[model samples]
Target chain A: MAFNTGAALMDALVLSVVSNESTYGYKITQDVRSVMDVSESSLYPVLRRLQKDGCLETYDREFAGRNRRYYSITEKGVDQLEDYRVQWREYAEKVDRVLFGGIDDDKN
Target chain B: MTKTEFLSRLAEELKGISAEEREEALNYYSEYLDEAGEENEEAAIEELGGPEKVARIIRANTAQSAQGAQPAAPKAAAEDPFGAAAQPVPPSSAYAQGGQSAQQAQSGPAYTQSGPDDTQSGPAYAQTAPGAPHIPYEGYEAPRRRSYLWLWIILGVICIPVIIGLLGAILGLIGGVIGMLASLIIGGATAAFAGFGLIIKSVFLFSSYPAGALFMMGGGFLTGGLGVLACAFGIWLIRKGVPFVASSIRSGWSYLKGKVRDLRWND
Candidate 1:
């Protein structure tokens, strides 16, 4: 029943992928599925939220026999993603430190 | 079965599901058709589940996903499919399942899919097709909502000088304390009497000449009053909303130009 795990992380990851170049919906969905456990339910909302916040822009491209929506990063989006990345990295490190204990001294 | 047929049936089956879920189910079924080959509806359907059983599973999964997303809704509200606040979940299979929050935090929450029926209550947005036509941001030109505090601050700023002037008048009535003390201490009876008389005369003059007294009280009151008025006017201008601000900003720019012209001419 606990569905919040890695949910926010997925949005951050999606932003990272879209930040690089224009990507279609299917590709983004597939990419998330390949690495981590992202429900299709989560991706749509994240995309909508990002668009609403002016972080990303979308256009349509012909794919297969139909037109598919393609998402691209905006300057605003890049800035937001950078902010998220900074926060996420710090958070990840802190989590790692606490969960694994002793800061994984091997990296040092 | 053809990909189109398979997708059509999947869509039909997932009618109560969110657009995201529906699209996902279609995509998944399409992928299955591609992988498992055509002429295998029975096999694919079997693999997924019988239509009724699949519907039940989809319902259960969607409910679970929705519950996962929105912890705030009541159990009755939770069960209401097509309620505008809950997420229209299809099944966990529609996406990678189970990455929900460990503890549902109140802030920075995700959007829960609400069905159409309850859309009026909560913030409801449709799962738009990726290439859906963009509805023009109609109110983009409209002004934003602002706090009423700015108006109050402007009014308070304007009142300061008036308050100071009133205090000054009260002191003038009380033998101009500084003048009375100085005259009595420095020059004894004669000076003190003169100072007291002068204070009485000033009070009488102020009582007779309200306008002159106010003017003598100086520009503080005027400045404060104008400041307050300007703030009130500013709030009024802003209250007309963003479109008003946009137009007024242009006018204000021209006013600035005219003021600059006046300043140059005066110089």
Candidate 2:
């Protein structure tokens, strides 16, 4: 819960949110905020970078009489997300083993 | 703080960012506040933190990401994202929005008011609302068009006269060679005519006056020798001048061919 959000992690989070459905900036930020303590402003730059990297695509839609830009995940973004997930699983498993190893030993 | 004040401050803080980025940020926050509704405006603003802090975070993130992607983007983004001076914004990553807007934005005003309809709303709702004038992010100036134009003009002015002078020299040398050949032909023909006439005259006079015939024969031989010298001079001129003209023509053709190749390559 208390960890820095590196670029890869941030990319993964944004891609995951966008992978579900095409979402706007604020909504994406809200969804991301549900899991992490991130500044709303920080999310915009991440979204922009992902879009720049071809991991995300944006389109404008009329919502409540105003144009809201929505971001959708690209095929490239899905691939990137898969890579991130694999890496995260490997990383988390290694860390979990070390951090929870003692408890398992005591139980055994 | 009210939403309008908050956004304007954020825009002010984001002065040096590209216009598209500035609009995207502004639109996102404005929509966020609108969704929060009037009752929660102040709370939403507090939750988002100060515009300055938010701007700093945004700028730092963009600069870092740009640095990762391109060698040039980071330099411009890092040098002064907040400075009043305008800087060129690199094209977004291949997947981002249309790159045309960034190019167009640099040529025109950085910010254009969206429209007048939204301003009629409450002050908090004014500016950057669905209908408000788009406050364009300022700070990027396109490269100077006039300077490049002037550079081309200067190069033309310097190069044209030299090319013309080279052409004139080549033509003049060809003309001089032709004139020399014409004079050689005329001189040889006149000497031959005179030598033959003197020889015939000496043969006719030999029976009547032997001393006078001897003088005419000597004169004929001298005239014949002069004609032979003229013929030798013409041959020498042909030997030297033909190669010189041929080489000059070849060099000029090669020079022109090289220039054409260069132009094609440049194109």
Q: Indicate which candidate wins on TM-score.
A: 2
What's the distance in Å from true for residue B53, model 1?
Answer: 12
DockQ of each: 0.03, 0.08
Supply candidate 1's per-residue lDDT for B98: 38
lDDT, candidate 1, equals 0.49
CAPRI grade, predicted model 2: incorrect
Clashes (candidate 1): 21
User: In angstroms, how far off is B132's CA in candidate 1?
Assistant: 29
Off by over 4 Å in 1: A1-4, A40-42, A100-108, B13-267
Q: Chain A TM-score, candidate 1?
A: 0.80
- Per-residue lDDT of model 2, residues A1-108, tens digit only: 322233355567889999999988878988887876555556767787788879999998888887788899999999978877776776677657767795785676
